[model samples]
Structures are given as structure tokens and as C-alpha cells.
Target: MRDRFLTGLIGYPIAHSAAPAMHEAAAAALGVRVHYQLIEVEGAGRDDLRAMLEGIRRLGFAGVNVTFPYKEAVVELLDDLAPDARAIGAVNTIVSDGARLVGHNTDATGFARAIAPLLASAPRGPIALIGAGGVGKAIAFALAGLGVGELRIFDADAARVARLAGQLAGRHPVRGVASIEAALDGATGVVNATPVGMLPSRDSPVPDSLLHPSMWVADAVYTPLWTPLLSAAKAKGAKVLTGRDLAIYAAADAFELFTTMMPSTDVMANAFDAVMAARYSPPA
Candidate 1:
């Protein structure tokens, strides 16, 4: 096992991230010392990202986790990508060897691990997936790999939905629908992959009326753990899964990739929960 390592995360608006604490705790549990920094390159464009990546390599970073607004953008910047990252069209974790940087998509497996307990059996019913951006794409691939019968996708950008459906057509039954209602038509599960329900916003991507008691709901927004979507779904008697599990699972995988050592899920999860509770808890 590596005695020491340096890792970090790159993204815009990363002030809300609990990744540093989570990664440090995981490293400690693995008997390693990891200094995980928050590289907040807000409002950075493609060229800026290239410079940032080069800088990290020169600075001897083990690797960096790429987050929102940069997951897809980092794909072209990497020297190579793991098969899953290539297939998912997103890279959430990058590993730097002295020679070159390689990318991986832990989000797919992370989502699968997070949603495992929520699924009593492999579902064969269509799933309503909203949003087709980076995280949405990863979740789409994860659900497909989970043996979902069909994926009904809806995105504000029609072309985004078409591209995602086309990318996934060979592996699963996918449909690019015109509206959320159409996506939810025969779906037994609903996932909100959009940022509509994230921090500072009280809105839900799926309207309460559209949510039914029979459907199980999941949200990728962990900032507000009980997102409006999950709240509404719970109110309707629907089974619910939050993004916290996904975050912890993804962090564990990223930690492993960065350090070449497995991380303790329990330690990482506890660290994440503590950070979120401290930051988001009301002032006493």
C-alpha cells in the first residue's frame, strides 16, 4: 500500500463538496496519509481545464476527482480512459501515473452500489430518467447494467436525450421522450438526475402530481438529502433512495483509484455524514 498520496477535486461551485473529509477518512482507515485538496476552478473553460490538468500532473498529484460541469469536459483531456468511463461518456475519477493520466467512471458502479439495497429484485419495468447531462448519463448506464427492462429518458435539451438514447440503444431498451409525463408513462422507478433539486433551490424536477405511490424514486442531489422529489415520493408512499449513498460509494471508488488501495466504506460514509451535518445543520 502507498504510504502517502495527494488527491483533489476540480469543479466549479465546489464549496458544497464534502469530498476532502470523506477521502481523508478513507485513507486513514486504509493506513495511508492522503492530502486531498479542493481545487475550485470556478467558471473555467476547456483551455483552463487543460492548464489545470497539466499543473496537477507537474505538481505530482496522484489524481483528481472531476465533478459537475467538468466530468464530460475532462474526457477529451485524458490520455486514456477505463472501459467503463469510455462507455459512460463521463469521467468522475482520474489517475495520474508519471507517464500519463487515465480516467475512470466510478459514478456508474457507485450508483449501482448505492441503489442495491433499494432494489429487492432486478427490475424489468421501464425507468423514468430525467436529465441527460454528465451525471444523468452515468446513472443511465448504471440502471441499464442493473437489468432494467426499459429506460425512458427526458431532457430539456432534446438533442441530449437523443444522444444518450443512441449511445445506450445497443445495450438496453431506451426511448427519448418528449415530456416528463411521457417518460413516466410505464416507469416503475423514477430518477431525478437534473440539478433542479440541488442546494438553494426548493424545486423538484418531477412534479408531485406526476409521482405515484407505485413508483420508487431516486435523486442525485445530496446537498438537500431529502430533496423535494424524494419528499414528494415519500409522501405518496413510494420507496426512496437519496444521493448520500451514491456520494460515499463514488468517493470510496475514487479513493481506491487514486491510492491503489481499497477504502473503508463505513469510515468514508461516516465522514461524509459528519461534514454534511456540520455544514447544513441549523445554528443552535
Candidate 2:
């Protein structure tokens, strides 16, 4: 049998994802062969998810990246969880070990790596975070571990925000605020963890008026790269962090989990940029 690895991403609406190119390029840089596919699982029920996981195992997938809607749910289907994944209550990466399926959360580490430089100079104070779902939960834990003194979380679903805040309270001072304005109050760094600024619609979670030049802003939406929130923050003269770095770092971590080897992240990043340019640039 040929020695090659197989992997893919599991998510609804994954047509716009850049993961395939990023991982495949990393595999190339590592001098290994990997086939990455997109397994769109929109409208899938628990049974469907279980069946899909079974199919992945039968097909000998090295691992798969979980995104949106399924990150938390996938935890229940796994045989084991990494300590951090269990603590954060989400899994963005899953690895297959013989008959065992293990889950891990690269999002937390990825977010920390992406935004550490920006937070280095800023004082330890309140950080405003919007959204409390899968990706949001991971980012919250990451920020808390990075020494964010306070976390102000807001979500349209108050219950989600409250739940996330409760989970994070032991590590950092967390508050589930009722409104975005309340979350931003006394905040020096702002993060948009929701899907508000993704493709199709150009809406941003935070308005330009709410952003200040003194604050640093970040968004988790990367399909468009320059998301509406990032644009508004840039216009307001605020330092901005795009979702691109988070995507790259997360995928790099997942790549290591799958292959048990470190891939050239710089090569993966260049591949992501090339893919984006090919998709977004005007045709000749």
C-alpha cells in the first residue's frame, strides 16, 4: 500500500474555506502526499454526523478539521479529548489513532499565536468579545490564558454568552453583557467571533462609530479576508488583525496533529495567499 495521508474539513457551507489549499501545501512542503477534501454536512442531524465520522474512519482519514455548528457537537463523537479541548468545551481538530478517534482544540492556541504580538504592548484590561459559540469559546479561553484581565462577552443568544462566561470565569473575570456597547465599555481590544461579516452579506458585528483608534480590532471571518469589521476598524485608525493569521495557525497545528510532524507554516501561508488571489482576483 502507498504511504499517503488523507484529510478534509467537515462543516456546512465550506465552499469558501481556504483549508484545503493550506493543508495540501503544507503536506507538499513536508515532502508528503495528502488529499484534502471538503465534506459539506449542512442540515445534517446527529445520526448523519455519526455516520460521517464512521465513514471517515473506514476510509482511513488521518484527521479532519471541524468548523462552525459542529465543533462542539463533534466532541461527543470522539473517543478522547485533549486536556485543553475538554477544558474549552470545543474541538476544531480530530485525529484517528488505529480504532480511536481523538479530538483537540487548535483554535485556542491558534488565536493566541495570531494576536499575541498585538496584545504584548497593551495593558492587561478588559477585552470585548462578540459571539459565544464554538469559535468564540476557544478564543475566550485563549485570551484569558494570555492574561486578559477581564472578558466582556456579548452574543445575540444571551444564554450562549452566559454559558461561555460561566465556563471562563475561573480563569478570568468574565461578564455576559446585554449589548455590544456594554461589552466594549472600558475595552482596549475588540474581537468579532461571529459570522456576521462573512460572505454574501457585508454586515459587520461592530459599527465604525463604536471602534476607536486607541483600540485594536480582530475578526474571525476570513472568506473575504478584509471583512467589513476590519475595514471599519482600519478606517477608524485602529490596529487590525485579520482572520487569515488565525486560519493559517490553526491549520498548521492541525497539520501537525495529523502527520505527527511540523509543516512549514510560511509555505502554508504563501499557499493560502495564492489561493485567495486566484479566487478573488479578476480574470485575465
Candidate 3:
């Protein structure tokens, strides 16, 4: 018997997401026929979102990936939340079982797995994280799991940063800083989870002079692969972790959740690299 085709991504402004490509490649490699689409729900009110969910249920989708603004919003619509998702107060992936909607958080696990090996060999020190939004919260929790001693969080929105700090206080020492420069001081690893260096403007969230050689920089923006934050980090001799790495790992996890089959990770990684390189390669 053939398994049902299923899974998709739900978010606004998903035109540049590499999720479809990565998931399609995994499905092809695993000999499963699956379909993953970008269901843009921007400007859609509550009723529209409800309708969309109903349509997905009717279509019998196994699951769907949520992103950005929708991560927190989708939680209210879910029937149950996975332990990790509940802890983080965010849901990046959702599994639909008949009429039950189960929410889960795979972003933190994926981020930690991708960067833990790199940090394992280095000396333990405090981490400086920029952007205190949904992705930032996930990364902060992941950092705690990775054994980070202290986290300095900075966000343009002071209230949001404070909220994130409060949430992480019991698990690890968290400090809410007023400026990015203050947060980066004596930091071992730096992370950018904001949209500053995403696509339209190639600008680093922090000044290059503030970055040191010993710091490790990770950006959460995958599109326009070499984000300004990463570029500056590379120039400063800081170990760089691209957002693409996170996407690859997260997509692999999502693939397993949606298909219940673990595809070749190496194949998926290689395919992701090839696709990204081709897309961003300089024109002749």
C-alpha cells in the first residue's frame, strides 16, 4: 500500500524558502511520493486561518511546518503541544493525527545539533544572542542544552528581550542588555536570529570592529546565504555557521516527522549545498 502524500509549510512571505526543495529531495531519495507546498496566509484573518486548517485536515496532510509570526499563533489552534514546544511556547512543526493537531518544536533541537560539535572543542564561555523573537527563544533553549553558562540577549524591543531573559533565567544565567555592543562584550559565541541581514539589505546587525577572533557567529537567515553578519564574522576570523546548516538539519527532522522515514542525511546535505550554491553563485 502506498502512503498518503502529505506535509507543507505555513507562513507569510515564503517565496524564498528552501523547504520545498529539501523535503522533495528527501522524499525522492526515500522512495516516497510526497508533496510540500508553501501556503501563504498573510493578510488572512482568523476566519481565513481556520478555514485553511480545515482544508488541510480535509486533504489529510500528515503535517505542516510553521514559521515566523505564525509559530506562536498556531499554538492556540493545536489540540496538543509536545513537551519541548510547550517549554519554548512556540511551534515550528505540527503533526496532524486524524482530528488531533499536535504541535512540536524541532528548531531548537536542530540548531543545537548543528552547532554543538563545533562548540564542544572550544572553551566554555558566555554566549551573546541578538533578536529575542520566536527563533531567538528556540536558540536560547538550545544553547542552554549545549551547556552555555551565560546568555546576553539584546533586542530592539526591550520588552521582548526581557521576557526571553525571564523565561531562560531558571535554566541559565540570562542578562538583557540595552545595546548589541554591550551584549557582544567578552562573548564566546554570537547569534543573529533577527531579520536585519536577511535579503533586501546586506547589513550586519553589529559592527565588525566589535567581533573578535575567538567568537563563533551563527545567523538564522538562510536566504542570501552569506549574510552581512556572517561576512563580517568571517573577516574577523570567527568560526561561521550559516543559516543553511540549520535549515538542512531542521528540514531533515521535519521530513522524518512527516514521512516516518529517515532519509540519508548526507544526501540531503549535499543536495542542499548544491541547490544553495547554484542559486547564489555569481553570474558570469
Candidate 4:
């Protein structure tokens, strides 16, 4: 490796993130050293985010993972956006390409890679996608790429769903539903992309009544891994997918993009699990 490199994540309430553990383990597996810092900013506005990105470039940091509310907003702050990021209208991984900061949407590719196996044997009927924000948009595009038959999307901000629907207009069959009930109606599976079930929050996007034994559930909140939404769905006998898979795959993709080094996803996955397990470990 060319000396030691620095990478990071930028998001609010990110104290629960496992990016550092996963990245560090992957680098160690490759005999390379890295420092993956978590840059947590609770209420950063556009100007604050711009300054942060500027600092990343000036400091010569490899790249950073953009998360939560900032992923969609950071698109305009970058010098250039990769084809996937531009198409999805979101950026989860931002790398410095020479002098320009280039944005990429690994969440889309990562979600697609993580969810494919789960959907293989499940019903091909319409799937319900909750939340149309940054991660939601990425998942929506990922579903389309997976060749899902139909997607019904719902978000509290109707305008966000409308824009996401518009983006996938000719690409896939998508409906911008008005209510969560409409989105989950007769769907094959449901994806909770909202931050409702994250740590310190017990809320779930869909009420327990909406979940049934036939539907498979996927939640994007991995801080707690076993989100309430996934729990409710599992209680109903629905096959559940954890946010951990998406987190690991997405982090691995970002690491490779930043360092041009292929990493062992298996090693990253082990690191992810160890961190999550330690969260509940009794302190000595």
C-alpha cells in the first residue's frame, strides 16, 4: 500500500456506526493499514457540509461515506458525480478523483447485491418500499435493477416520492402511493428505509398489523440491526433481511472505491458482527 491512508464517514448520530471496524479489518486482511474515522455532525447545514468536504480534500483524506439526511443534499457540493450517483440522485460514497471530488451511489449497487439472494425465491409480485429519502432512492433504483416486477413507494414527503417515481418512470413500474396502507397492500415484501427503528428509537415505519406471514421484510436501519420493523415482520413469520448486509456491502464498495484495493467482504462481515455483538456485551 502507498503509505497509510485515511477514510471516514459523515453522518449525524453516527456513534453507532461499524464502518471503522469493518474497514480496519478489511485493510488488515490485505496487510494494509487504514484509519477509518467517523465524522459525526448532528445538525450540519449545507454550508457546514461544504466546509467539511473542502477539509476532506485539503487534508488529503481518501474519501468518505455520506449517510442519512446528507446523502441527497451533498450531490451538488461535489465537483463531479459518477453515472450511478447522478442517475439515482444520491451519493453515499464520495472519492477524490485527482483534484475533483466525485460522488458515487454504492448504496444502490450494495443493496442490489445484498438483496438479490433474498428475492430469488420470494414472490415476484409488487414490492413495497417505505421512505423515499437518500437511502430509499438508492434502494428503489436497486430494486429496479434487480428486475422487480413492481414497486409501490410511500414517503411522508410526497414530493420526494414523486421525484423518485419520475426518475423510474420509463425504467420500471413504480407507484407513488399516498399512504403506507396503499404501499403495503398485496405486496410481496416491504423495505423499511426510514430511520424509525434505529437505536434509541423503538418506532417502526409500518404498524404490526400491516405485517403478515407471507411478506418478507427488509429494514435499512442497522445500528440496532434487529429493528422493530424486522422484529414485527419476523413475528408474523415473514422472512427478514437485516440492515447489516447492506452496511457491510456498501462499506466494502466505498473502501475499494477510495483505495482501489479489493477487500474481503467476508472479513468485513466478521468485523461487522463482532462490533454489533460487543454492543450488548456486559462491561467488565
Candidate 5:
């Protein structure tokens, strides 16, 4: 009999991740005896990563999802990096083949597909993006691939944003701005790629007064599901795309990558919806 397959997500502070439930449901639907684990390697440095890889090999695990600070760090340790992942400078999915670990990025493609329907009929214009970190790089490239006319980038680390702007310059009209106010002015769409509205910080990246009804908003943080930036966008009458969409889409991509099977999206969506409902439901 074939060894039961195992896969999981690796990150620090992964207590709140939905990946375990998502993958477990997919595995059940496929009739596969797959186990999804969340390995928390808090402050896991180079040596910790080496041990984790060895452990995965020892257990004969199929693959793992890399998140947050590990995305970029794991790349250096991988045996191979997919072209798109190399371009984005991040990897969210990894597959281990014996001693070889391959890194790939499905986040950009997944996110692009999730938001495609929303942008189908809207007027294409410049998008102002706040943040130039790992996820930001993926989102920026995804927007370019989706055919955005221009991109205005702003980050607290001005140098990083400028570097990303330079990398994306030829792809589209790229402008690096120092002020958030300048970045948001007359922008067709706004993306909050920063962790500003994430768990610990419930404050909106931009004040509600600054948001316009015509703008479209996308947030990459899903913990709270409806982030302050998204809330402000909804209040301003903007079409809102929550981080949950990205999470679901990325999970679907990972499911396919790990299982090589297309699980029913409707089933997965229903499972995710139920989980979200239970999570946000009021106390009895």
C-alpha cells in the first residue's frame, strides 16, 4: 500500500491560519488520507528551516505552504525556484521531491483570477498600492499582468518601493510616491498591501474622508476578514474585494499543486463560508 500523504503550512504564529481546514476538506473530498499540519517555527532561523526540511523528508510529506517572513527566506534553501516566483521574489508554496525542494508562487496568479471578474467592466486606470514587501511584490506584478494602465507605489520604506517601481517601470507607467495622500489622489483602484489593518492594528490605512465612491479597494489581510480599509471603502460606496477572496483562491491553487486534483470549488467555498460564519457569529 502507498504511504499516506501529508502536507501542511509553515509559518510563525500560524494559530489563525485557515489552510489546515481548507486542505483537510479537499483531501476528504478526494478520498485521500492526507494530513495537514501547522508547524509553528517561531523565530525559526536558518538552522530551524534546515531541521524542518529534514523532518518533512523523514516523514515523507508531500509539500508545505510557506507564509509571511519565511516566503523569501525559504527560497534560498530551495533546490529550484519557479520563474514567476523568482520574478516576484517570494514563494508561498513548496514541494519536496526526495532531497530536492522546489519553490513556486501561486499567490499572484490566484489573486489575479479572483479579482478578474470584478475588473472586467471597470475603466482601467492607475492603481495606487501601499506596501512593497513580499505580498506587495506579488500583487504589483499581478496587477501588471492583469493589464493595469499605470501603478503608483508608496511604502514607509521609500527605498524598497522605489526599487519595486524601477523593476516594474518598463511593464507599465510606474510612479513612486512618498506621500499616501498623493498616491491616492484620482486613483482608479486602491490596494492595501501593508499590514496596517491586520489583526493588532484595526485602523484604516487611509481615513474614510479620503476615500472616493469611484475607487475600488482590495485588502490582502484576511484575519479580520472585513478590515478597516475595506470597511472604509464600503462606506464610501466603493466595490470591495476582501482578503478572504485571495485566501480562498490561493488555497485552491495550493490544493491543485499538492494533490494534482481539482477539488470542487463550490464545496471548498461552502466549507470556507461556514467556517467564516462560525468565526464571526455573535456570541449566544
Candidate 6:
């Protein structure tokens, strides 16, 4: 394996992502070297994204993690897609084998690992999933892989919701609901796959009235790990899962793909904690 690896993460408005810290710490712990870059841009249309992917190839980056808006859009620009990426219809990680750019969806695997224990003794089926974009698709597929009896999905974008439901057709039990209430009704658990509770947005996607202590609630926004949604869920005595675990696991999976060596999740978690603390700390 190469001693030094150059990798990065591609996403929009990613001024605060802790991915670099997590990956670099993992590399150091494993006795390898890695330089992780943040390729963030604002208002990037399709053409701009194409140019960025071309730049990655030309710059000879080992691999990159795709997030948010780019995870789904980047799939078409890659030379090939791993089986899981194709199945999930999204790409969260991309690697270069010196010849081909292969897209993979580590979000699915990461989420599976992160949420597995939560579902181990709890109800796993008939869950409500908010948001239907890139990460949402990966989460839906992950839930399916975990043998979720059914997924009730809702998205503000009507067309996007339809697209996701269609993709999961024949593969698992999924249905696109008209509203958050529809998705949460009779559900045993709920997951917030949207960016509603992320930094700069303090709103909860689901109303507190809709939440119950019997349900387990999860949010995929880690910027403020304790999102408004999770807070409300906690207030209701519902078991909550933070986006922090998801972020760590996903980055660890990507790091392994880039370095061909698995990383210690505990070390990655420590790195993530340190970075998050610094990001929120006041300048001295």
C-alpha cells in the first residue's frame, strides 16, 4: 500500500464538516499518511460539478467522500459504480484504482453499522424517514438491508419522494407519504435525513405533538449533534441517535476504502469529538 495518500471530500457549503479531522487521525493511528481536503463550493450547477470531478481525476486524488447534494449527482460522472452504490442509487465515496474512478455508497454501510445496535432490541419496521435526497436514499436502502418491515418516506419535493420510492420498488417495502404526519403515523421509529436541524436552522422537521416515547428518533445532522429534532425526541423519552455516529462510521468506511486498511472507530470518534469541540469553541 502507498505510504502517503491524497484524498478529499466534495460537498456544498461544507465549511464545518469534520471529515478531514476524522480521516487524518485514522491515518496517523494506522501508521500511514493522508492529506484530506475539503472541496466546497456554493451554487454549483451540473456543469460546475462536472468540471470539479474532472479536476479530481487530473489532480490525481486517491479518493473522495461525496456528501449532501453531490452524493447522487456525482454518480453519473464516475467511471464505474460499486454494486452497493448502484443498488442504493447514490454514491457517498469514490476511489481511484489508478485507472478507473469507482463510486461507492459507504453511507448505506455506515448507517447500517451505526444504527444496528439501536434496532437490535427495538422495533425496526414501519419507520418514518424524512427527506428523500441523496443521504435519504442511502438511509432508506440501509434500513432495507437491515430487514426493515416497511419505510414510510416523506419529502418536501414531491418528485424526489416519488423517485426514491420507485428506486426501492421490488427491493423492499417502501412508500412515499404526503406529509410528515403520514409518514410518522403508526411508525415505531423515525429518522430525520433532512438538513432542517443543521446549523443555522433551529427548526425541527417533525412537530413535538407527533413524537411519542415509544418511538426511536434519529437525526442525520451532526453540525449541532443535538439537533432540535433529537432534543424533542429526548424530551419525549424516545431513544435518539445522533448524526455523529453516522458521520464517524461513514468516514471510517471511506478511509478504509482509500487506504485499504480499516481504521479504529474509537480513535475516529475521539478525532471527531476534538474537531467538533474546536469548531464550537470560542477563539482565544
| TM-score to true structure, per model | 0.97, 0.97, 0.95, 0.98, 0.94, 0.96
> lDDT of all predictions, in order shown?
0.90, 0.90, 0.84, 0.92, 0.83, 0.90
lDDT of 1 by residue, 134-248 (tens): 9999999998888776899999999999999999988999999999999898689998988888888899988789888888999998988998899999999998999999999
TM-score of 3: 0.95
In model 2, the number of clashes is: 0
For model 6 the TM-score comes to 0.96
Rank all candidate structures by their TM-score, best first, as comma-separated numbers: 4, 2, 1, 6, 3, 5
lDDT by residue (1-284, candidate 6, tens digit) is: 57899999888778889998899999999899899999987777889988888777878788888887788888888899999999878898999876679999888888999999999878755999999989999999999889977899999999999999999999899999999999999899999999998989999999999999899999999989899999999999999999989999999999989989999999999999998888887899
Q: lDDT tens string, model 4, 22-115?
A: 9999999988888999999988999999999999999988889999879988999999999999999999999975478999999998999899
Best lDDT among the predictions, by candidate number? 4
Candidate 1 stretches with Cα past 4 Å from truth are 121-123
* Candidate 5 lDDT by residue in tens digits, 164-208: 897887787889999888888888888888878878788888878
In candidate 3, stretches whose alpha carbon ends up further than 4 angstroms from where it belongs are none
With a 3 Å backbone cut-off (N, CA, C), the pairs that clash in candidate 6 are none
Q: Candidate 3: global Cα-lDDT? A: 0.84
Better of 1 and 5 by TM-score: 1
- After superposing candidate 4 on the true structure, give the runs of residues whose Cα lies further than 4 Å from its correct spot: 282-284
The Cα error of candidate 5 at residue 249, in Å, is 1.1
> Which 10 consecutive residues of model 1 have the lowest summed lDDT?
115-124
Residue 84 error for model 3, in Å? 0.3
